[model samples]
Target: MSSTPDDSTAVIRKTALNAVHRKLGAKMVDFNGWDMPVEYPAGLIAEHLAVRSGVGIFDVSHMGDIRVSGRQALPAVQHITMNDASKLQLGQCQYSAMLYPQGTFVDDVIVHRFGENDFFFVINAGTREKDIAWVRENTRSFDCKVEHLSDDFTQIAIQGPRGVDVLQKLTDADLSKVKFYWFTRGTVCGLQDILIARTGYTAEDGFEIYVPTDTATSERVWNEVLAAGKEFGVLPCGLGARNTLRLEGKLALYGHEISDSITVWEAGLDRWLKMDKAEFIGRRSLERQQTDGVTRTLVGLEMIERGIGRDGYKVLDENGKQIGQVTSGSYAPFLKKNIDLAYVPLSHAKVDAVVGVEIRGNAVKAKVVPTPFYKRPKRS
Candidate 1:
């Protein structure tokens, strides 16, 4: 299925589970050029709540993966990425980004260390070609080899509060001992030696499994996980709920939160920007910006009036002057309030600072507030 007749005529690619999604009555839409399910018949809100309180599964096979291996892999990876890759140990992962020479984004990525000289990257689907090209071109000078492994695997994410219990039922490995941002291999659902990582985008305790891309294996893994989690209220989630979940966690989206036009400082990603690290791409530009100071920064907004401010909605100051625009916004199903993430002038980004979002040509009142609007209580 496609979002419109025009979309159907285009060369839209589908995941291995495209038919399964249609059979489940998903509302399919053209995301970039990929035919993806935006929401299920159960609706976005229901799927959102299921992940927050119970468990939800997502077909994330469309996301791309790359592998780098060689004795100089660390220097090769460090040259292209902003984080300090030397700190990564075996089977560890870190949230990092690949940037252009201008100190702006190529794409935010998750770097995983599989071995001493072997590293992997999970990059955004929309920027797959660009990211791959950037990495290959820039790191070619280093004594390392880069391989495009995107087509070899399909990734499945099981997220939410009850996600752990559901996943442990299928694997013999002791998932409870796996630390956050760590990974291990095990036979799951009779699939031999697949990678299971304690990582997710939903800001919940969860695991993402890496399985072969064959439709039969992928569907079997999907169905078995659903059946195993049926008692825990696990639902099949689509991109709509996926967006809301990541937004609620203040997770950076490549196009929305970070982009070629947006600098790392403006996106509030200082924690991952290591200036003391060995010289890397965009380091000099970021260092100069740090001295000059940032003009605008990202902030969380709570809509005070009775309307939902959507992405690209104009954010106005108290005097009805346009300041910034909403990068992401929604009536958060789990939070039960309208919330947004936006970039405004430093002067207006303070906590409790009043601002207005132009909703339907009218400036609706909103206020700046703390982020991660919802955080699950830590396990006992």
Candidate 2:
């Protein structure tokens, strides 16, 4: 398939489960070439509250799933990603990024080490083809293999306080033993060959279940999960709530936070990079930049006034000098306050510093705040 022009306005295509979403009365919207549900009757705020208070299920099949396996897979993957994939143990997952030759980010992904010399990568849907091409091109000289498995499987994300409780009723797998950022394959809800991972975008406890793309199985499991989650008030959430929930957690979005123009360190995702690892794409540039310090960085901002912050809003100082721009912003339903993520000059990113967000022609007062506006209460 050919890539569509960036400015094309044709109606976005639907994922395989669009029928299920429409049957549930989801409010659909165009999201990066996919006609995805934004919210349901409960609305975005209600869905947000549900995830924070209880649990919610999301249809995340739109995300690309790529498979990499072969004898030389470890070394080939290590060369493309900034993280040290060669050191990953089986059953562990590391959030990492694929970089361009020039050291700019191509996509931020979670690489799951499922076996020796084998891994699975969950990449942003928008960058699916680009990521595949980049990996294939780099690995062509090596003996490893790479395949795009996005269409071969479906992903269901169950997130919130009661997520584990709801999921445990179906799977005999020891849910308690699964640590954060870890996963294991087991039977789930009587379904075989399930890949359950304790990772999610929401600032809550959850799991992303990977199941084969089958009609009867998908339908049965979907119905079973909804029924099992009855006690938790787990709403069928959509992309609207998902984005808000992730932003509140200060999780970086691909186009908004870590784009081709932003380096991992400058995007505040330096922790995911492994600088000490032997040569990888962008390592030298990142290492030099880290030693020299990044000029601009992504930061969290809180509105001190009534107006809600939205993406692309210009940031300014008291004197009306433009400083930065909002990358991700919204009226946080949980806090009932406007919150945003923006990139500002390193000097202006100090915590508690007062800044101005230009909404329209007026400069609204705002202050830099610590990230993850919502943190899930630690479960014992």
lDDT (Cα, tens digit) per residue for candidate 1, span 162-205: 88899999998899888888998899999989999989999788
Whole-structure CA lDDT of model 2: 0.85
The regions of model 2 sitting more than 4 angstroms off are: 1-11
Question: lDDT at 298 for candidate 1?
Answer: 95
Candidate 1 off by > 4 Å: 1-10
What Cα-based lDDT does every candidate model obtain?
0.90, 0.85
| List of clashing residue pairs for candidate 2 | none
Q: Judged by lDDT against the true structure, how good is candidate 1?
A: 0.90
Who wins the TM-score comparison? Answer: 1
